[model samples]
Target: MRTALDVHISEVGPRDGLQSVKATMPTADKCRWIDALAAAGLREIEVGSFVPAKLLPQMADVAAVVRHALTLTVSHPGLRVMALVPNRRGAWAALTAGVHKLTLPVSASEAHSLANVRKTSAQMVEELRSVVALRNEVAPGVPVEVGLSTAFGCTLQGAVAEDDVIRLALACVEAGVDEVGLSDTTGMAHPAQVRRLFTRLRAELGSHAGAAHMHNTRGLGLANCLAAFDAGVRSFDSSLGGLGGCPYAPGASGNVVTEDLVFMFEAMGVSTGIDLQQLFAAREPLKAGLPGEPVYGMTPEAGLPRGWRA
Candidate 1:
């Protein structure tokens, strides 16, 4: 359990980061990267998504990656492996592979929901119910987390209604999901909106409210994360080197950079259980995994503030 002063950074680079890029990371390299991330003290990681190989070749080897991540848990007892699932089938496959948690993305915007998953928000809630039921039968101990993407806004639709987001979140919770997370999928979220929505979510879902998945598209990723933290959100999802973007939303930037976010928290005297130097060192395996791919991070480029200590 994390205290109020303790912030949990869930690394989504391997899963969310790789999916956006064209090149497919070798299965062995993916495992090495994940191991490096764990060694750097990232206790929770989204290793991969269980989508079809035909639809996303980048995640075709997700099962193999999950097996490797499970093995890492043997050495790193505090490590928690998480995978993304699109539906009940994916959820079953992820559970069989022994992930500690499964995150199902439910779009708050109806247009984005249809475009991304070919289902409406209401239909996604029904799917969540079925997925939860399947989890109860197969892996009763495994948790299911629903990420309400486009909760702030969507590209397909101009503005997503806050009422709609709240209602959909309530519906997902009623459908028996263990937790509900908010995602700025299109990178249109502002700090004030992040704080407001998170406060409302916590009020309605209580402890079941999950992580904040913010994007750096508009350069407010860190600011929005701080707003969410102020509103009682302890868990945050970010990518190493800022390597992720939504395929459904055109022109959206990658997720918030993990190294920068860690620096922000550690500088503010918040403990993330992650070492700055080791965390930056983990970027080596990531670069090796995806040769020629561009990775972004202010902390890595600026070499940490002068005379700074973590």
Candidate 2:
């Protein structure tokens, strides 16, 4: 059970943010950015994805990035290094790299699933089962998270049914994933929908219900996050500087800004354990790594509110 004061913010800029853009952040700079984030008290970060370099050139150095993140875990014992794995091969690479957590994206919308991974949602669930079995065989302690992307609404196939989302989540759980999260891959989720779906997710999966991956494309990312938080979601996934988009779903913006999300929690008396100022400072390495890349954040631009402390 999570108290109102506890909120876990997982930074995903290195993997999700970088994968969407054409520019590849230097491996060394990625480690620097991740170190800065951990230093800012961010306990979990999706360091990189274990995908083929030809598929996502930006994540070409995932192995090296994971090694660097592991060193940070040595320094900051609570830090969790996570990576995204698309299939069995990626999962093998992530397990070999010794990531603390691995997230597999399973699109809830069949159209999006076929487009994103060339598999149907059910096929992806079967793939998840294989990945989970591999994890148990190799590293039983490591956790596997399934991000049900396009759960809210899909551009390729609009109006994703809530029942479908729930069914898919159950399949993932039966497949042995440690957690299953909901992702607004297209940023089409409203606050009411976010609350209702998250509540349903909790009712169905209980502690297996995972993070809320919201997008700021429609400007409701933070609102939807707050709704999910109210619905008892403790973990939240965001990208520093709002730097991500979906390759399969066109016009999808970056994730909810990490700086803004942290501020929202810390200001509301929820302890995110993040240093707002240091989080802002972490953006420098991002800029240096991807020159000319657009990094968006309201808190960084407006500065802290008058008389406010985090």
Clashes of each: 1, 0
At residue 122, candidate 2 shows an lDDT of 93
- Which lDDT value does model 1 have at 159? 96
TM-score of 1: 0.98
lDDT of 2: 0.92
lDDT of 1 at 264: 95
List lDDT for all candidates, in order: 0.93, 0.92
TM-score for each candidate, following the candidate numbering: 0.98, 0.98
- Residue lDDT tens for model 1, 1-310: 4644389999999999999999999998999899899998899999999999998999999999999899997888878999999999999899989999999999998888898898988999999999999999989998899999999999888799998898989999999999999999989999999999999999999988999999999999999999999999999999999999888887778999999999999999889998889889989989998999999999999998788875
Worst 10 residues of 1 by lDDT: 1-10
Q: Give the per-residue lDDT digits (tens) of candidate 2, residues 190-209.
A: 99999999999999999899
Report the Cα lDDT for residue 277, model 2.
93
Question: lDDT score, residue 140, model 2?
Answer: 94
The parts of candidate 1 lying over 4 Å away from their true place are 1-5
